[model samples]
Target: MRRASGSGAVAVAAVLGDGARYEAGRTQQTVRAGQRITVSGHGCTVRQICAYRVVLEPAAEPDKAAAAAAPSSPRPVGGEADGGFCFTTNPTVLATASKGFPPRGDTLSVLDNGGVRRFPAGLSITVSYVDTRTRTARLRGDCAAVAVADYDNARVGDTVEFAGVLFTVSGLTERAIRLKRTST
Candidate 1:
């Protein structure tokens, strides 16, 4: 994978099964597991995403001849042509209050995913009160309560909207909850 010049988007080289190589183009699309993308008109579902490589599975039968005969020109898909990264589309982690921390403030590790995950310093919810037992959290942005997670008890795969951004609860643990941003 290579970063596009001046854009910072990731560009990958797609190699077909028949040894045909082509540039998959630069995409700023925040893809998640199970999302579909088209490479040179061949549909593929994103299987797994790592820091360097994105694994894709064939979503439909490929037009082998078409892919092989196509030019090596870059084709943009999924993301906008504009530059700059969009943080709202990626997965985010939120930490729950542990044994003895007060329900307020924004500096504790246990209350902020061990300080490993944050909302980019000034965007989205800045402070949250999470209940590990109930698996819920009261998210606050700029001292105003913006969202809560008690409507459905914050189970895995549950979705919550915080500060106008929709996110799916992709993972949950005693320490943190993983939220993946969704188009909806």
Candidate 2:
């Protein structure tokens, strides 16, 4: 074992046997395993960190004590997707339900969960609707990207729920839907 030291604001002073004095900033580090080192430098008032490795004996029977001591995986949070909605929470659902919507990095929790789920900053919609004239309703294909106007097949006065928000389709095109928010 060896002694290590670090400094905050005051410099470390060492006195020699002959009454000589040496003053310098003190910082400590572990250059290698089982060895600690301290170096003196100018204005080095930073915190000291050290790393070491521990070795445990191999278990005689793998399941005897290991299962009791092993930690179980943590439970999923409310927003975690496990065989449920792709975007579980209201805010996440809202952020992902619309195309051309900016992503707030500060609000994102899970960075990646395998497949692609990002959209460009354009008005895209996956609309399933019943034609008012013919009264026909069908589900759109998954990953079906289309303009807002095409959602209801150019129906001028139709509404759809996206991310739990209702939007009245006011105008349309092959790739864009002009929507009027009717409710919060």
Candidate 3:
């Protein structure tokens, strides 16, 4: 089946890696990873702008054959990332790091796999705390940052170094912070 207009996972892959960019008409653009660039679409040509940011949606890779896999459910709209990145209907979701922030004062939250993944990359925030396994971050620390990054980016089960933190996402209408884990 054909996807709406020109939206396809392959089209997203067509612009993979940094330095590669594509403009899809006047409403859409694709920019590769690891580079600050904007892929904007004109009437028929997509323009690449320097020093701008582009975000790519992540497609879920199935663990088994498509026929064997269960039909997936729709992700929550405007939700945050807990297990992984969230999918957004709007493609302009991304965050740019303003500076290398210290983990101190850093805030964290979990997205229940609804709206997006890794906060879309262009969000900004203040460092509340950081460790190899977990990040302690506050929502108000940065607004755009909350919208751009995800804690599931956290990696666990490392013998030595780890970054993914243990936390829960709260405050749906406002800033959500880490709910302290009560000892059993």
The prediction achieving the highest lDDT against the true structure is: 1
Q: Write the per-residue lDDT of candidate 2 for residues 93-178, one digit (tens) a residue.
A: 33434433323221111111122223322222343443445432322212223211212232444544443344444543333334
- Model 3 local distance difference test score: 0.24
RMSD, candidate 2, Å: 26.3
Q: Which candidate would rank higher by TM-score, 1 or 3?
A: 1
lDDT of 2 at 70: 17
State which candidate, 1 or 3, has the greater lDDT: 1
Q: What is the RMSD, in Å, between candidate 1 and the native fold over all Cα?
A: 17.5
TM-score per candidate: 0.27, 0.26, 0.17
- Candidate 2 — number of clashing residue pairs? 9
Ranking by lDDT: 1, 2, 3
For each candidate, the alpha-carbon lDDT, in order, equals: 0.35, 0.29, 0.24
Q: How close is candidate 1 to the true structure, as a TM-score?
A: 0.27
What lDDT tens digits, residue by residue, belong to model 1 across residues 136-165?
543332211111112224444554444234
Reference-based lDDT, residue 30, model 3: 49
Clash totals for all candidate models: 0, 9, 45
